[model samples]
Target chain A: MSNVLANILGASPVMPLEKHIDVACRCAEQLAPLFAAANRGDWGAAEKAAADIEALEHEADDLKKEIRLHLPKSLFMPVPRQDLLELLLVQDRIANRARDIAGLVMIRRIQMPASIADDFLDFVDRVIDAAKQARKSVRELDELFTAGFRGAEVDLVAGMIEELDRIETDTDARQFELGKALFEIEATLNPVDAVFLHRVIELTGDVADMAERVGRRLELLLSD
Target chain B: MEAQIVYIGLAAAFGLFMAWGIGANDVANAMATSVGSKALTIKQAILVAAVFEFLGAVLAGGAVTSTIRKGIVDADLLSGSPELLVYGMLASLLAAGTWLLIASHRGWPVSTTHSIVGAIVGFAAVGIGMEAVKWDQVGTIVASWVVSPLTAGFIAFLLYQSVLWLVLQHEDPLARAKRWVPVYIFFAAFTITLVTILKGLKHVGLEISVRDSYLLAVAIATGIAAVGAYFIRQIEPDPKAEKEQHFHTVERVFGVLMVITACSMAFAHGSNDVANAIGPLAAVVSVAHTGAVSAQSALPLWVLMLGGMGIVIGLASFGRHVIATVGRKITQLTPSRGFAAELAAATTIVIASGTGLPVSTTHTLVGAVLGVGLARGIEAIDLRVVARVFVSWVVTIPAGAILAILFFFVFKSVLP
Candidate 1:
């Protein structure tokens, strides 16, 4: 059974789901280059990061489309069809939000203020943490399914999801503080840069928000 | 003697034509999943179908052939004029074959079983009067039209659920699936062999009592299960693949199971569908040779073989169109899902064959697939296709009946 080759085109929901998680992480990875370019005012590097993020997001979108098109109108599955679709929607949105942030970085062209740079990076790090936790929970899904969504493993994944929510919650408070700091420094900074930077901050936060949603989706899936 | 030879030859030809239609259209319903799932290539599917359909028919075809010949029409009434019965039988075969050809040309998914049964009833009602038709048994056969697919569906639903509960739902699915593979194969073998032995082998003249058949079935099942375990034991999980493609390893296990069950499905199809072609041919041959008709006639091996040959030829000649249609429809068959549908269809068909019911393999397969859909996989199934299949079933009986009635008059008038 193990050595046997599956049809390269075999129909399973696992492939798209796995790809969605992978691309979400890849989108998150682009944040480093995106932020580096923004800080250095290297528009060239920032443009590349933004384009790559958009491309990865589209690729994930293609995978999602393939899954939807190939998913039969009727099938005998262990999970509800709607549940699987909703899970994929959140997973794809994670990448889409990351792409949006990359787009914002390119559009705003705002250099990070030297005073708030460290705090902003810390805030981005927490958002990525929440995103990673979401991806981690998605990965644990295959394991949970094999475990019949029961026993210690189910509880273990639920714990991980709870941790993701907590991380997202913590990031929210930090983001609010950062927003206040940007307003406080508005007189010293270019007013346009301050406004766009706030937009960039919110978009960056969305990636984590989408990831938390995915975690919650999985938690709901296994409660049955 | 020359006249008798000519009559026999003509009857045999019409029989072959009907068998070919069954092989062309009906056998594809069973083999489609194997090809669609990539468990067997098209060539491999043809080879498996040819060999197993032959084996199934030669081994177990007698049961349904008996039903086809005597169960619908009263041979006792025809005993006074055996030649008329012979002509009537030949007409039914030709009419059924004609209807099949027409249906195929138009791309209609009609059942071979319905056409043949309708042909028999039509000939009996018009040629020998309505009293010659066994109305009570006719009711039972009609009821089975609805019952067969539902039974197949119920079985498929249970099998798919069991696979989920026993294997896919486990904490370590690949490992758990490995443990369950032999168990699944063991049941496939057990049920296939049990039905074949208990009901099918009587056609081959190897009549085992119930106890002996059960014992033989168990032994055969165990041997096949042991072999399945050997091939399965050789597989080692690919850690890299497991990481990249979750459940790819588990799906591969089901691939092997799909192959095993595909063989059983071909065998089941052969046992039941072979009778559709040869039952009337045998009745015609016996009357031509002995110049007498009896309620019970032995199904000669050569007659059964002729039906087998006709099916193989039909598959070789006309199977492509139906196979293509099936391949297109069967889009997303992971190995376990395909296995669930195949196992259920085969089990139901074989059981029906043993009971001397000429159930439609296509109908039962549709039912089995719907069962898989009902279990939470409905997004992958098209209800429109299922609805179309039901409509085709309704059309098949009357179409064949009208054609058979017309052919009966033509044969009788020309012969006299």
Candidate 2:
């Protein structure tokens, strides 16, 4: 039977948006394994990690596109449709950065200098943590929508975004320290190796930057 | 006398057809939220709808029936020739049923209330004269068509906002829900019961004073609340589920409340909508039995029972599938949100019924859902569909009018 009431409730993008961030987070999570395998000189395992990140990134891209397709302009949502699309774009980039960093490290077979190896790995973990934090924050989209982006739910998501900003800031500091360490060892290593290592550090740092942007987009939705 | 029997038979048949259409289609909107939210399974929803819809029609449908039977048409003008009233009522029923069939086939968002009202006005104004149609009463009904939805929407917005403030937004939402859900239950139950006792029971031969009505409504509501609280206390929080979605157990608490609202929704729908089917039949029966258009005659109890029986039969035969399909499509309306819309719509429609206004239940519900959406409760609503509903609202009246005018002319020429 043709039911106006059923048809009136367009497909909700909240759960799908939540699931999209989940996939993006999973893609960024592979970075931890890629670095761990690389530090042990296990090229085979590192290649597998890179491939896994690539696959997850592709999954995230598909989900992002599907969400966009369903979220037509005709939908009347609590938040602006454009705001949600922007949030989706920032979320997708987390996976994009993860894949990019993995590709750069794998193709160049770049090895960290012994002095900065531990510090660099710690830096990678911190950046991954930022993406995880973004995921944690985005996961609250359902609750945020439920509360109409006001009152206690807004405060709760604000706290999450605050913690995400702190993680991103810590990643920035780690990136600065790693850059300085690499600068000191430039003459000892091959010139090309030194340049590519710096590029990888910058690209790895961009993951945290993108994760922080996800928080920014979500914050825009929280406002009246 | 033989022709009188013919007129009554034709009127009853057309009336049953109209009631069947309502049960087959409109009832789905009334019960879908409960099933969609998993607050009541399909079987339970059907049972609740059948029982409560019948009660609403037999006990509370009198006022709107009177409005439809005598309020729209100027029966005084047709008192000298009562056959004209019978033919007009019969023609209006046929026009509405035919229009509903065509509209449903084409998947248009048409309201049965709009169709019947339009057909009645069409036949009276065109077949008789403009003065034969009560323009002031028609104006009031048309105004109500616009006003009811807005009122339901406003109530829904406030109700959902209260839910957010008093329960969902609290840090310990589960505890707050347990503490406050029964109070909401009491309110929902109280409003529907109070209105029915004060306005509906009079036709059923029970003249409850205003003071006693309040006492009775409160007693019934309190008992329902106590039972609801017992159910809420039984729901233990699943820590595993709560870790993923914080409101897991809290929604369960709301589910108990949704069941109560669903019943009210069905009752309200029956109270208002059953009149669309039986009002014309009542007019035809009264005219045929008296051989005069006597507006003062009481509506036969059997006619109300017939309308109720026809609706239940329609539900058993067809509405169950419609309910299932609609329920599956609207799973986005979880118990917490569904209850708000249902309660708001039920309150608005029940009050309208008490006031003898026949408002569209679907339109009222659509308004309530929009109200919740305004409060940011629903995830998404298709504005395009809403626009289409508005378009149909304006179109159905004219369409029903034109069809009714045609049928009136044919009945005038053919019927004795």
Candidate 3:
């Protein structure tokens, strides 16, 4: 690297993790508008929200890249590099899943049925909440780091992970209910639409599941 | 065996080069936040640093600027062979200065204090004997490396909590800021000046008794508080900014305090680091003039001036990169947080300088910033940078020692 670029490259590894978490949180935020717009059959609005999610996911990718590129080979990290990179991958996956769902929605123009509209929206809302919970937990890395991931901070994050699991489970149950409701009406609807709707429902649930995985990745980091 | 103009000239040149490097790299740590946070523009920061650093070295550098590395090497060992000590001093300075420049070029993070100490120990062990290197004093300095930073951390933590309570969390933040900010300013001013008066400038001919120093400390504190209050009074409350961040008004209250602490930090650094550059230079001058190395002697004013001027010139020329690294790395500093970090760092440096202890001001500052991050702002800091810094701290001493060992033999063979 050139001298001017070298300083900038080696310089700001300080808070890229937090910056990454922020991008994750912002990407999670796009889910509500994306779904709400799809519910109204506003393809333009849904596509716009999906585009926003794509942009945020790209930002999170760049921050992760900056972090990886600048991470010195001889650092004395309290948490190992492999664990941090694992955490980054898992955290980035939350944004990735959200983008995936948004991309599917924009691509298929999946229309929301009146029967499952409220319940499906609630499922997406809970998934976004889980993603946010993961962001909040990741943010505690600083305190956990300063505390060396022990004592009260560990307990606090452990509690956050437990709550995230609960939220994810609750979201899972909601997805199942929405799925049941979709199936009940499946025979009366177009067969192709039923298949596509089921696929979209599973992908949306995957967003929350991936967020919970981010939390578990931290648990492994702390315990290890 | 005439050690004439040549020896003294070599010492002065190396000494000036070492001083320039410190001003460029180490001293920038003092004013970094003020420059980084835009509290002081680059030109303005450099000007402020130049003036106060000059004042600090002239007024307070004497006690510390002896012809030795704070007695780390036993000077008595070299009395029988004064010329060897001269060559050792010259070699130590060159080795340390060369290591610093190389480290900077390679983007290695290391402390100048560590560089000089390691160089002195390496040369002493080779030139005189291993016994001539004062392990007891070296032990105390090594222990202090841990003690001083923890002390600064504890100080910063308390300051952060107090600032949080006084203005950040209070219902009426403006009233609290207007009422309490100047008091904190007074506290910082009084403590630093008290240390300076009691400990730093004894050789400047004003040996005020401890009682008089206390009186002076109090008088200066109250005067500073009064002027600071006048400045605080003019800052009308902006409710919009307060609504934007409940902590905004509180941060504003700390703006003046941060600038004050920054100047104190620069002053403290000047009092301490100028000595490192000029100590060996002073020995070379003494040996060349008197044809013998006295175990101890007075530090000439001209030597102090050379150390001070070299630092200033270095800061003017090449201190920007060091300043940028310090100002922008580690953590994002708000004015209040910067105030706490600098205040704690200044306190540590002042206390260390007063009693003649060698410590890295940057390490203490980093620890203070770490302390703040531990309290409630950890998310803002980059743990990776802190880790890299720790690795650098571990590497510098051994690296400097090894390099000095190599250079000491080369200097011995080459120099007459």
| Cα-based TM-score, every candidate | 0.86, 0.96, 0.75
The 10-residue segment of model 1 chain B with minimum total lDDT is B376-385
lDDT per residue as tens, model 3, A101-200: 8888888888779889988888888988998989888877654543445555567788899999999999999989988999999988899989989988
Q: Say which candidate scores most in lDDT.
A: 2
Q: What TM-score does structure 2 among the candidates reach?
A: 0.96
lDDT of 1 by residue, B103-198 (tens): 867767678899999989988998889999999988888898899889988988888778777776655667777788888888998898888887
Name the lDDT value of residue B381 in candidate 2.
Answer: 99
The CA lDDT at B385 in model 2 is 95
Over B1-416, each residue of candidate 3 has an lDDT whose tens digit, in order, gives 45558898899999999999888877777887787666676777787788878777776666556524447878777778777777788878887898888877877666777777888888888767899898988888778778877988889888877766666545455677789889988989998889889887686777799999999999998999888889888877677643322345556666777777877888878877787789889888888888877755667778888998999989988886667666665235667667787888888877887777777777887788777655553333445656666787788887777777777777778877
DockQ of each: 0.17, 0.66, 0.08
Q: Rank the candidates by DockQ, best first.
A: 2, 1, 3
- What's the lDDT of the predicted structure labeled candidate 1? 0.79
Which candidate ranks first by DockQ, i.e. highest? 2
Question: lDDT by residue for model 2 over B1-416, one digit each (tens)?
Answer: 99999999999999999999999999999999999889999899999999999989877899999999999999999988888888889999999999999999999999999999999999999989999999999999999999999999999999999999998887778888999999999999999999999999998899988999999999999999999999999999988766433687888899999999999999999999999999999999999999999989999988998899888988888999999999999987888899999999999999999999999999999999999999889899999999999999999999989998998889888999
**Clash pairs for candidate 3:** A14-B382
Tell me the RMSD of model 1 versus the true structure: 4.7
